[model samples]
Every structure is written in structure tokens, then in C-alpha cells.
Target: MWIVSALFAAVIAIFAQLTIPLPLIPITGQTFAIGLAVTILGLRYGSLSVLLYILLGAIGIPVFSGMSGGLGIITGPTGGYIIGFLPAALVMGIYLEKTRFTSSHAIIANIIGMCITLLFGAIWLKYFANLSWPAAFTSGIAPFLIVGVLKAIAAALAGVVVRQRLLSAKLLTTKTVSH
Candidate 1:
């Protein structure tokens, strides 16, 4: 489980580099990686992977978006979204675990996760960047809405398919039954 979690953490790092620069926050593959990790690894291991990724970044490892790292990055204006990944992963993983690991459920869970990330990000950006709430929403959350939804759907579809293959190969284990 630790090894798998570590691998997922690495996946998050790699995905983080797939970024599209924005004014306040770049559109990166981190959210997609977060959804995929939780969808495939479930609650425990999935959350662990997110924690590991954050820890790596906090320790000055260049594992975050744009290959940047260190505590400053986490404490910066965009830190909220990065920090939000943990709870988002936890909630998403729990939803999938409690319900079903099907694509539909994963999609719903990932959307919820996306909102959680955006909420944290917008709130954090408001304070850290000294911006108004409306400004924060405009810069932090608005641009990501459509793109986030599309990423959530992609994560769900890809995650479920990959998870099914892993389960079939006995490379992974799950407590919840897939639909």
C-alpha cells in the first residue's frame, strides 16, 4: 500500500508539471491526479498519496506545479488549493467507498472534490493575496469551473478503467464492490 501510495504521489508530481499558466493560478493536472488517486486507491491509500505529495513539496522537493516546491509555495496565494487536496481526496474516496466505484459515482465524487479545492483556493487567495471575495472568486475559481468539470469526468472514466484492470490483475485490492 505504501509503495502504491508513493507511486501515486509521483504521479501527482508528474501531472503537476502539465500546467497552463494563468494569472492567479495555473491550470494543472494536479486535480486530475488527485481524483484518479482517490478513485483508484480508495480512502486510506489515496489520502496517503495526497499527503505524501504535499509533504514532498513542503520539504523543498520540486514536486508541485511548474516543478516548483518548498514551504513558501504552500504558504503562498495558491496554497489553499494545494492544501485542499487532502480533504478533497478523503471525501471523494469515502464517497466512492461507501457507494460504488463505478464511473458515475467517481464523476460525482470528483466534482465534489473539485469544488472543495476551489473553495479552499478562493478563500485562501482572498486572504493571502489581499483580494476581495469577488476578486478571489473571479481569479481563483471562475476560470477553473469548466475545465475542472472536464478534468473530473476524464479522471473518473480513466480511473475506473485503470482500477478495474488493476483489480483483475491482482495488483490492487478494494473493499467496495464495483458496479
Candidate 2:
């Protein structure tokens, strides 16, 4: 499961490295995948999944966006976000467990995760881009909200759908056994 999560997350990370025209942060769906991973895998596995992704990248695997890798990726403008994934996963998992996969819980958890990751991402952007605080927000935190919300919604939908499917399958099995 851990390996699956890690490999899945790494693929998402690489996919997420795609750039959209945002002055603050580059657009990527990796956050969506991260949140999805947390919701699905829960805390320990989720956090490890993201952590392993960073480690993989740092080890020079071309698993990051733009096919980039190594420790330098973490030291670059987007490094904060890379570093932030673990804590973000942790936060997402905690909320998932406590909220039990309700929509409200998913939303709140997602927002918190987004904020934390953005905070780290912005700080790293500043260090690398040599931007002031305001500049960082203007450039790094401003343009990603729409996509983030979309991703969260997708995660919620996936959860609801998956949950129902599992329940339905279990019911069918139980019915068959009773006959």
C-alpha cells in the first residue's frame, strides 16, 4: 500500500509540475492528488507517501514536475511546497479521521492543507525568488485557489462514490451468503 501510494503520488507530483500562467504559484493538480491520497490512505501512510515523493526527487529521480529532481528542487522557488507535503498530508489525515469523510470535513481539511502548503511554498519562493512577503502572496498564493477548490471537490466526490461502491459490494456478498 505504501509503495503504491508513493508511486501514485510521485506520478502526480510529476504531472503537477506542469506550469500554468500564474504570477504567484504555478498551477498543478499535485495538491489534489495529495489531498486524495490523505483521504484514501489516512495519516501514517499518507504522510509517508508524500515524504517518499520528496525523497525520490531529492535522490535525482525525475519524478517532479518538468522532469526535475535532486535537493536543489527543494531549494528552488517551489521547495517550500515540496517540504510542506508531509505536514499537509498529516493535517489532511487527521481531519479525515476526525470528520469521517464528510463533505464538510473534506472541505475544511483541504483548505487547511492548501494553506499550509502555500505557506511553505511561499516562503520557499521568497528565498529563491528574492521576493518580499507581499510579493510572494501576490505571486505564489494568489492564483491557485480555483484549482484547489476544484481538486477538493473531486476528492470529496471520489470518496462518496468509493464509499458507496464498497458498501454496495459488501451488501451483495452478505445477501449471497444468506441464500
Candidate 3:
């Protein structure tokens, strides 16, 4: 599980490079990675995975977006969004674990997690970047809405499929009954 979690964190780092840089926050595939991780790893390990990823980035390991890292990056304008990943993973993991891991539930969990991340990121952007609410929304949330939804759907489908496969192979287990 630890190996898998670290690998997923590395997957996030790789996706982070797939970026479209914006004025404030770049659009990247990290969110997809987050959704995939939470849906696949479940609550306990998913949260740990995200937490480990954050710690890696915080220690200047260049695991963050754009190959950047260190406390400065985390404390920078976009840091809030980065920090928000933890809670987002935790919430999504918990929500998904408590319910059936169907496509619908997965999508909803991802959406809720995405919202939590956006909320934290936007508020942090407002304060850290010295931007107003509208400005923060424009920079942090607005541009990503459509892409976010698409990512959520993709994550749901992929997570469910992969998890089912793993469970069939006896490589994974879930609290819920076998689907």
C-alpha cells in the first residue's frame, strides 16, 4: 500500500508537468491524479497518500506543479490549492468508502472533493495573492470548472474499473460487499 501510494504521488508529480500556465494558477492533471488516488486507495490510504505527497513537496523535493517545491512554493499564491489536496482526498475517500463505489457515487464524491479543494484554494488565493473574491474565483475556480467536471467523470470510471479488476485479482479489498 505504501508503495502504491508513493507511486500515485509520483503520478501526480508527472501529471503536474502537464500544465497550461495561467496568471495565477496553472491548469494541470494533478486533480485527476488526486481523484484517481482517492477513489482507488480508499479513505485510510488515500489520505495518507495525499499527506505524503504534500510532505514530499513541502520538503523541496520538486514534487509540486511545474517541478517546483519547497515551503516557499507551498506558501506562495497557489499554495492553498496545493494544501487543499489533503482535505479533498480525505473527504472524497471517506464519502466513497461509506457508500457503494458505483459510478454515480464516485462522481459525486469526486465533485464534493473538488468543491472542498476549490473552496480552500480560492480563499487562500484571496488572502495569499491579495486578490478580491471575484478575482480569486476568476483565477482559481472559474477557469477550471468545465475541465474539473470532465476529470471527475473520467476519474470515476477509471477508479471503479481498476478497483473492480484489482478486487477480482485479490489484490485489493473493500469494506463494502464485493460488487
- Report the C-alpha displacement of residue 161, candidate 3, in angstroms: 0.5
Question: Per-residue lDDT tens digits of candidate 1, residues 90-130?
Answer: 99988998899899999999999999999999999999989
Give the RMSD in angstroms, all C-alphas superposed, for model 3: 1.9
Model 3's alpha-carbon lDDT is 0.85
C-alpha local distance difference test of each model: 0.92, 0.72, 0.85
- Superposed on all Cα atoms, model 1 deviates from the true structure by an RMSD in Å of 1.7
Q: Candidate 3 — which pairs collide? A: none
TM-score of each: 0.96, 0.83, 0.94
For model 2, state the Cα shift of residue 46 in Å: 1.4
- Runs of candidate 3 with Cα error greater than 4 angstroms are 175-179
lDDT of 2 at 22: 56
Error of 1 at 112 (Å): 0.4
Show the lowest summed lDDT stretch of 10 residues, model 2. 170-179
Query: Where does candidate 1 stray beyond 4 Å?
Result: 175-179
| Tens-digit lDDT string for candidate 2 (1-179) | 65656765775676667656454456777787777666655666667778888888889887777778898877777789988878888988887776676667777787788888888888888878898999888777777667777777786666546544544666322222111
Residue 20 local lDDT, model 2: 68
